[model samples]
Target: MLNTGLLELHSDCQNCFGLCCAALPFAASSDFAIDKNAGQPCPNLRNDFRCGIHTELRAKGFRGCTVYDCFGAGQKVSNLTYGGRDWLQAPETAGQMFEVFPVMRQLHELLWYLREALAFRGAESLHDSLKLMLEQTLMLTTLSPEELLKLEVHIHRAEVNELLLRASELARSTARGQLNPAPKRQKNYGRGADLIGAKLRQADLRCVSLRGAYLIAADLSGADLRHADLIGADLRDTNLSGADLRDSLFLTQAQLQAAKGDLAAQLPGSLQYPEHWSVKL
Candidate 1:
């Protein structure tokens, strides 16, 4: 986590070893143009470690590539953990590097969310604990490849998640209306619920838990998602026109990229509008 002056927790391909392309596997489905096994270099991966189809990925039927976010794991594993020993130059570390990449990705994702919850409004009481967990997660990423592979990330994740849930509850409670009275919230969102193509336009979803929900192709136009926990929610093809997510919890760039959105939608300050989102809104 040494400062590289790059936006930490965001992908910076220039400092990476194309680990995602070589390490990740994808099937020949709607997202991918072809099937690729783990550790196999994508046919489109160039000698310089840049995607050959960078501009044409979606057009070339690799739509999934466009939505994928490594959350800075590529550069971290390549530059920091492995000490810039790329698979091409070192060769022997390739397998271990590939294995470690996903582990690092998960740890980094957790770090991102912890930091989010730490800064969230009305979550001040949990700040000390959040900072400690963030530091602990950061220290885990510095372990050797073998150590990283052996690490039981889920256990750490569960502990962190419990803390995060408390933070979420605290933050959301502050948003609960005492005077003017906010809209009656939508129902509690179970993880991985099938919400594909469900009509939910203009819904009041304040302070709800949409964690790991499948919101693919769901119409969420003009919905108010303030304080909603959206970690791991599949937002692919979810319409977000005019939706208010300015205070939503754990929303990632990949989610926004996978979903359809426009300028009219408000996002958390940390997130930027996806390039594909329409200016017309």
Candidate 2:
């Protein structure tokens, strides 16, 4: 399969059946304005399977929806798995479709990471293995709903994470060699650290691994995050004004959407500046 095909793994809301809004349950919390039950269509969901308040979700206190990404699983199940049929069209199949959507979503997320791992030139030695894993993941995405529900996705994810860790190490090691020598004290390693509301402004985080770190409400303004791996890092309310994240790895749109930043924050090309961000540097 073509590597470019992997790009389609991103969400295509127009082609989706609003599976997330319908299948996932949410409570009235800081993220959502109202409680929604599993398999129930969200109140804002239109008959066309589009959000009635899509442009104003944040303003309406539905920020949770804005940060959610199904990794293209919605369309894959709506069109391919269910053959373009929807819950309304085929009520009998609705239950199984919802069950299968989350499973497919997990598989698609793995595909996203595997594709990124394959693109890491620093991990060239692991290219063959990465490609093999990508192929295996692609095969899983094509499985029927029955097969997908039977999948132990966590087992495969653990295996892929092993290779991804190696890739991360190689990439960071190479980046470190290229950076100017600095005092050892400036080095920061906060992998899986509880850094919520921690003061980290202007910190030297270059070539660091903040994977799965809880950075919510952390002050990261002007911090050097070049080549940092931010996969699964909680960035909500983190002040990123002027932070240098130009080459950070595994930074997704959802993470960026959840965080607060200004125009001066340098992001990788794969991501776009949030429109709500302040223009001030």
What's the CA error at residue 62 for candidate 2, in Å? 0.1
Q: Would you give me the overall lDDT of model 2?
A: 0.86
- lDDT by residue for model 2 (1-281), tens: 74455446789999988899999999999999999998888989998899999999999999988888888888988888888998988889888888999999988887888777776658899999988898898788888989999999999989988888898889878777777874145545567889999899998888788999999999999999888889889999889999999888788888888889899999988888877676764
* Clashing residue pairs found in predicted model 1: 192-212
Residue runs of model 1 more than 4 Å from their true location after superposition: 1-7, 178-181, 279-281
All models: lDDT?
Answer: 0.88, 0.86
Candidate 1 residue lDDT tens string, 154-194? 99999999999899888888877531457584576777888
- N/CA/C clash count, model 2: 0
